[model samples]
Target: MSDVDVIVIGSGPQGLAAATSLACEGLTVLVLEKADHLGGAVVSAEATLPGFVHDLYAMSMNLFVGSAFYEKHRVELQENGLEFVVSAHPYASAFPDGTSLKVSTDEGDTLKMWRAHSSADAEGWQRLGQLYDDFTQVYFPVYSSPLPSKSIASAFRGLWKVRATTPPAQLLQLVLSSTRSFGDRYFTTPEAKSLAAAWGMHLDFAPDIASGALFPLLELYGNMRSGMSIVKGGAGKLPAAMARMIEVRGGEVRVGAEVVQIQTDGRKATGVQLSNGEVIRAQRGILTTTPLPNLVNSLLSKQSVPSKMAEAARTYGFGPGTFMIHLALKGPIPWLDQELSDVCYVHLAPYVDDLARTYQQAVAGILPDEPLVVVGQPSVIDPSRVPNPNQHTAWLEVRAVPSEILGDAGGDLSEISWDEARDIFAERIIDKIERYAPGFREQILAQVAFSPVDLERVNPNLVGGDSVSGSHHQQQLFGFRPSWSLNRYATPVNGLFIAGAGTWPGAGVNCVSGPLAAERLLRDTHPSKRAFRRSR
Candidate 1:
């Protein structure tokens, strides 16, 4: 007899979403997590001090709470105790000149901030917001759904309506322009341009890359509409609630049950083998949430995946790793602009060119002198992160760090090893923060620095420590994600599927990949069920 109807391998947001969705569809689901604790990268831990909780990787739920999965299941999840907290100010960018640009939840306030910098950029922001509204109906659905999906036609229609008289090539170029190019066209101020450009680093997109404008634009639009949110107690609460939903719906979640291999026949996968030699068979199918490389190269034996397909999986481009630092502070960050203390999210990069150079340095295997930094002060919005009311917390991340450090971009440091580079880089990042937030270094009671290697060690899925799963460059995006063959979450081997950040819609806590995989699985395997879903 089969062990379960379906087996999900990994407990990341995507894996949890898929498992719960499948269980709600009345399938017997078993979720196996390699870690001792569940919630993969979304979980929070006391990395610095005993009472200070820190988000391991992803912190903001702007994407997660805004996702279709969350939208569909909000009531059910809220019933199970999923709480979120949001700030009035979305994010800010601080410059060396003691001037900063802020994005507020209130549009007029945001416009005023832009106006203070440049009236032309203020107009540009309004124009961009209007343009975003035109594309919202079409873009959101298409992005959160499978490619060659029904929503693609609607997107085309929306696009044509927006650019009725424009030539198709010009329209394509407009949509596919780089972040820097778009900034140049839209904004007059370097402040606005740099703010938008800095956002590209989140998706591993450099300034001049094609299709790079989307992230910055999307972040601005969404945060402008509804301010960014954080999980109430901790980031772990999200997936823990998902686990609860799955259990109440009659699914099982197992931690410390490491899946070592996929036992398969010549044509199809039969079941998974645990590290301890325990075998669990899947009656319906298997959703492999680990990276495709592990799935194709380790789990499945040779000849299971085609040679070329295996090569593609091996060559799957994982971009720059992030160096994360969490601090248990005595008080708030002392920003020169006191208004910044109220904001939770801050991007610290001098200019768009500086952000671009960081990416370039990362790809060239050099440590950035001034890495594109994101500092999140969740305790400002929700004080539960710290133990006492008197205490504060800071979450700092230096993005686009080379996974394998070949040299230091600053030329002040050498000895290219993350073990050595971790502290040195963290010091540099804190030094940058100290420049803007005087007394920043003094406020730190205790600090924990996690190198790219540290991230990889904790989560195997974050291979080489790339938080985005894979690079968001043109060659590996959209339909070409993971690989063209594995685009639809299906593999050559029957009953074996891949789903995760490596899939379409890429990474983030958005929970798109899992649900998309679930929908496709139902469409392909249970036609009657798909029809029923459609009818409903």
Candidate 2:
């Protein structure tokens, strides 16, 4: 009566991770991807020119690298050709003054980088490193596992240790502080401050938002401890590895199969109806990674989801859109500051204030005058991205850009079409970069610009080009992610579950949500195994 134990819809990072987990558990797993390719936004291509590889979305896999789920499956993924290329100088943020603050995997090098800006900040970095160690011991388990009592107990145990030493008020401040406030309190120089603010915007958080400090602390210090790395060839290798894992385990990963409907029988989901009119019945459950709106409207019928859940999905706050520029360079980006050429990821923000204003303007539905652009030269880390060792290819993601092709927020441009606007906006982005790296624009052999609309065309989950699926605002985060009712991946409908950026532990190519959902689903279907897992 049933074909597979679990049918995972979509082949995004989280979806693939979920399906892989299910398959590894010896459950019959089937992964359906609507697109021709398996990886969703993580796809790569020679969009600029032949021998030039570019990632549509450059999601850092540090979370995946550190995840407990990934550790369990590391050998399988690596065996399937998943290899990471690390940068000695991991990340940096540059000011127009030609000064750059860089972070290195070597603690001494990173401390020296901060010490140049402020001696106090160097000490602060050491303190932050200590705090990061403490936070990781407590929260990472919670971030990795299902929200069970044992997991919660681990979090409490870690918190109790911190409480014994640190004051309650300072601990609360550490928990709830904003990046801007946290930076201001700890570091006196703009260099150290800019580093904190730059990392915060990687999520939807602007510098001054509450709990925004968590990301910077986690990103900067944690990445320092656990260096960031790109896939050996391209970011696409990650999903390819996941698919390979499922296939080798005798599970099916089918592309070009669009899931049109979730077939529910009054109280439980039975199967999925594809757009091609084929029905695949599941013995146990259906796991979806679609955006909240599409899940409630397109997949499920009207009034199927409870009113509160439907309202929550309807009112889900999508974050600002992104604009990206891809280039196949004749040679490396000629930088005025030669130190910048070695760093893998660089944040091009004139000042911390400019970064904040850019976010504000994008939220108001307009392009930022000086956008916070993350210029990534993956070739710096992996030379395989170029045709020759001397030549290079790179991509830059301009975050918090308006999804709509309206005029610039600063009233600098007037065109209303993305086709007309993308090039001009790209020019502005190039101009900003050229200010720091003089011959930057001339290094391009071929260049392509993607407006917000172009992003949506590639990945529908990036609705209105909001790449993180939906916003990470306080009301819509953690236990209240997606919705308060649909929290732990399991929906109101029995035998139905969800995962991906739309769920808890929120955004990034991080495989957090997938395994979390898989663990829950595994426990639900095999109650006997649940006690066995709990015992472990």
Candidate 3:
């Protein structure tokens, strides 16, 4: 008999979710992580100063709260010490002139805010909200179900049911529309348009990118209904809770165990070989949450994978990089519009055209003069993260940066390595914030910056510092994610599954990939279910 029924590599949310699911099913499972810490991108640390906790990468729990895994295991996970803090004002945008707009759960108040901009915009906002409601009935089911599966087919049938309200052609157009087009079609004012368009940058979607409308619509409407949530203390508590859940179910989670290779038996994954030269056998299978390139190039022997599939993995695309700045503040950010202090997140990009320019600049390997700065204020909702009541932590996400610096659009930091230029770029982000909130620099008790390169160093899956793992462009999403053949979370090699932000329904804290992968494995392992497995 093998040492364990299955061995899962990586302890990211996806991996942990998969392991926990399998463990709950009474299977013997083991999770291995390369880093000394367990959580992959969802880690928390005192990066800026002592007693100030910062979420190293991911912060928003909006997607997690809406996931099936959370629904099934909510009580158990909470019993294992998972808790969430939510905000009524999920997100907002701050203009340079000290004006702002936000999406609130109270529809009346939100409409009132939009009416202040334009009555036409208020009507437009309600119409968009209706569109959101109509689209999500199809979107959520299709997203949660495995791509190209019976469930996906059923989801389309459900879409067919809504055709009287939202025609198939209209829905298809909306799906393919750019954020800019969507904004123009819906709202009149730039403030109203940008309030939705800014969310596209959360993924790799620029305002003008095709197939980008869905994200902004989903985020804006979804957050308005559900609000934004964060882990009670820090993001690390999530993985810790998951690990406890796995352990209670007789599974094991180990840190500092770097999986170096998949020990294969011709076409089947037998086990994983660690960097320490230790091989742990998996009787049933091995699931990997590593990026596609690493999986195809480094872990598996070249002979075990078909040349075409290997090529696809090697050519898997990653989007523009991201830079992060975490601040330990003497107090909350003194926004000129103090109303922003209560909101969970504020986007500092005021115009969709500006977002387009910055995105194009980053793609062309130029450091933009003005980048989109996403300011996350977790302390606004959760106070347990700080040592004192007066102190606070700020999470700044600098989007659309180049992984390799070629030139600077600003023309000041050209030809320098990221190591030398990280702080300088961070200064530009602070300066951008200072424009909206004067004396912002004075509130900074301490600050730490993570360049794109630094992000990749911390998590290899975040290649090029593309925080969403890989680009979610139409060609690489849904059934074509990673590749057409590997879309079902199964692989060319039997018993070797792959899942992560790089898989279907890509990115965010939407802990779906892991559970989907586990579900696939479970179905494949059943004695009478083998015939149903898709051909590799």
Candidate 4:
């Protein structure tokens, strides 16, 4: 007998969203989390000190704010004591030359900031800003909704109409072109180009990568419209909010419960067998997120997943790893650029070439001598991030490692000590930060580090600290994410499905994959209620 209508494995953003949506539909839902809490990597916190909330992984919810998932669920989250906050001026990237580029919700103000760096770039910046605003207004809704490619097509048409006023080919060039090559199309100056390059590199792809140009505009929208906000107290607030929502809707989230295997009846998934030997039954088993290989070799038996499927999963690559440093400072970081004081996020790369080198080094299994570090003072934006004014926290996220580096490229994460590696990474970051911000080393009251190894140990889905869930390459995106030519969320197994960052709409705190999975589940159980198209 089924105890619940659906059992969702993993309580990350996608899993949480899936569970919440299904629960709201009056379906009995049960969420299982390996960790003792919710939010997966999205809302994790590691205490480097007594009162500092070091975001274990992601530092901000900027991407989530760009999604309608947060908007639709904002009232519910706030009622549960979760408040999403943002800064007035979202992000600022600085060069050693002291020149900088800033963005804000106000398009005109953003133009002024860009103008300070280059008047020519200022015009291009204004145009791009308006284009981003238009794109967000039109495409963001379809992105938030669980709509298919037809909806994307419709949104593309709307984008075309808006871009028609500009050069006819500009829209196509921006969307389809490489950020490294096409980035120059928007800006002429070096600093302006560097800013755009760094923005696209957020996913860890180099500027020359195809469709990388599209990310800069998306990043701009997310940062300017909504500054990265920390959940009050810690990053875990987001997951807590999801758990509260689920409980209020008559669902339950069981933490410290590791799902060992998916029980299948040859043609369909019946339920899950926990690591501790508890067997829970459900009408539909929804695995909200997981890498393809683990889902095959670890969760399902050989018969359930064919050899061809396993082979395809084997060929799929996990993305780059992030070397993170969390600092509990004795005092606030004193920046040479006073304007940087209020900044929540900082990308410390002098040139586009530097950003490229960082990624190149990572692919080669080496960290750059000079890494691309994203530094943030969470306490400045959220008072509760620190225990007192005397105490402050800074998160330094660097891109320069691979998930498979720590162990035998194929062994499980148990083969390494991620915690120790994290300490080494923290030292390098403090040294780098001291370069621009003098006496920065003196302000350190406490410090903690997370290597790619540490990230994987903390969350198995992270897979060697590759935070974007899986590689965001073209073949791995859309319905092909986690694998090409497969409807990821809806697996071949009848009652089994996939979710999490490894699914479509690919990683980040964005809940598209989760909510989309829920919509698919709803459609699967009640096909006539909602319609969805399969990949063509």
Supply the TM-score for candidate 2. 0.95
Candidate number achieving the greatest lDDT relative to the actual structure:
3
**lDDT of candidate 4 over 1-536, digit per residue (tens):** 24788999888888888899899888889998888767788664656777677877876776676566788988888889777667776677877866567666676677777777788988877677667766665556555544345767777677676765544366666667766775688789877788778876668567777877777788766667665666667778888888889998889999998999988888678888899898988865565477777788788888888665677678767778888777888887878787887787777876888887777766766556666788877788777777787778888888756554433221223334545445555666677778778889999887777788777777888876888867777766665666654463677777777777776677678878888888777777564332342322
Q: How much lDDT does candidate 1 score?
A: 0.85
Residue runs of model 2 more than 4 Å from their true location after superposition: 410-412, 527-536
Off by over 4 Å in 1: 164-171, 527-536
Candidate 1 lDDT, tens digit per residue, 1-536? Answer: 24888899999999999998899899889999999988888989888888898887889898898888899999989988789999999899999888899889988888888888898998988888766676575577688777757778887887777675443454466469899998997898888899989888888888989889878888888887889899987898898899999998789999998998888877567789999889998866888788878777777787677776688788888888888999999999999888898887899987998988999998888889988889999989988889999788898888888889888978867756899778878899999999998889999999989998999888998878898888888788878888887788887776777788889888888889898788666556575754575699
TM-score of 3: 0.97
TM-score of each: 0.95, 0.95, 0.97, 0.91
Q: Global CA lDDT of candidate 2, please?
A: 0.83
Segments in model 4 whose C-alpha atoms lie over 4 Å from true places:
44-46, 145-148, 404-421, 527-536
Structure candidate 3, residue pairs in collision: none
Instruction: Kindly indicate the candidate among 2 and 3 with the higher lDDT.
Output: 3
Write one digit per residue (lDDT tens) for candidate 3, span 1-536: 23999899999999999998899888999999999998898999888888899998999988999998999999988998999999999999999889999778887888899898799988888888778877888778889978888877766886788888887777788899999999999999898888888999989999988999989989888899998899999999999999999998889999998888998889589998889889899987889899888898889888998786787797799999999999999998989999898899999998999899999999998999989999999987889999999989999998889998999998889978899999999999999999999999999999999999999998889998999999988889888888887888998788899889999978987889999999899877764555565452
> Which 10-residue span in candidate 1 carries the lowest summed lDDT?
165-174
Compared with the true structure, what per-residue lDDT tens digits does model 2 show for residues 1-536?
Answer: 13888999999999999998898889889999988887888888888999999886864677777777678888888889999887778788888788888888898888887888779988888777767777777777777765543787888777788765554456567668888998887787877787888887878889878888878888888777767778888889999999999888889999888889989888678899999788999888889899888788889977567687688778888888988899899888887778888888888876778889999888877789988989898888889888899989877989888887556775767658777788888999998898988988888899998888888887788888888899887777777788877788888877788998988888887888898788888877676764575698
Residue 409's lDDT in candidate 2: 71
Error of 1 at 325 (Å): 0.4
